[model samples]
Target: MKNTILRFNDAVYRLCIAVAGLSMLTMALIIPWGIFARYVLGSGSSWPEPVAILLMVVFTFFGAAASYRAGAHMAVNMATDRMPPALRQGAAILVQILMAVVCLFMAVKGWKLCANTWNQFLGEMPGLRVGVSYLPIPVGGVLTLLFVLEKLFLGDQSHRRVVRFDLVEESEGAA
Candidate 1:
């Protein structure tokens, strides 16, 4: 059951990444096309503005997921690192649990926020409707929270060792 959950989470994370990348690509193209149409073709696209906003929303969520996976999110590890090994471990656990709680809150809040804007934000866009753009926030929160929980427990071999990823990162990039 646990393995199944992790695999599902991994699949979801990959899908989120793909969707975000597509959003970024689409946004990039739309912006350039709109600019080119205005300057060279002497006309502007009405579709690009709404599309760009949607794509940007998707981009933010996916970017956050990627950052979470990469451990690029900010951390105040100074005090944790200074403690003894046992205390450090405890501190890490405490901090991770706090993060999970915060992520859960984010997921719930984001869903409410998106629900409030539903359909109303669905303006003209090149891709999915504007309201759908907000979908990524809750989706990303779930993915991030799951991934973090997995790391804290299972330690995904494909990603990084949970307790000592900084050393892994340092070594992996070392000359």
Candidate 2:
């Protein structure tokens, strides 16, 4: 059971990385095109700026979830690291609990925000709904929540073979 859950989470982590990476790559490509179009072509494209902004939102949210799972997210451990072992453990658990609450808030409130604006459409991208653009909030919230639970129960899979590709390659080379 534990192995199965870990495997599933490994897949989820990969998916988040892919989504975030793709969004960033697309934004990178499109922004340059937008600049070129405006300066060289003497006309600006309407879709690029709005699309880039939306992609940025996607990149931020999804990338954050992946970073959290990989233990790459920013964390202020100055105070916690100074504590005794037992106190440190308690603080870690408390931090996870607080993270869960924040995730829940993001998921619930983000979903409501999406629903409330579902009918509205973007002026820049008329066919796309405003709510659709905000989808990363709730989706990222749920993904982060999953990682939080995995850490709480499975005890930090950051060192796992799936999460640590560099370590895996080193081990394989040694073998």
TM-score for each candidate, following the candidate numbering: 0.75, 0.92
Model 2 poorest ten-residue lDDT run: 163-172
Superposition-based RMSD of candidate 1 using all C-alpha atoms, in angstroms: 7.5
- What are the per-residue Cα lDDT tens digits for candidate 2 across 78-131? 999999999999999999999999999999999999999999999999999999
The segments of candidate 1 whose C-alpha lies over 4 angstroms from its true place after superposition are: 1-3, 122-130, 156-175
- State the number of backbone clashes in model 1: 0
Sequence-dependent TM-score of model 2: 0.92
Q: What is the lDDT of residue 103 in candidate 2?
A: 94
* lDDT, candidate 1, 5-109, per-residue tens: 654655666676688789889998899998998899998878788778867987887777766766676778888879999998888788778878877887998
* Candidate 1, lDDT over the whole model: 0.73
**Which residue pairs of candidate 2 clash?**
none
Which runs of model 2 end up more than 4 angstroms from their true locations? 163-175
Q: Considering summed lDDT, which 10 consecutive residues are worst modelled in model 1?
A: 156-165
Highest TM-score, which number? 2
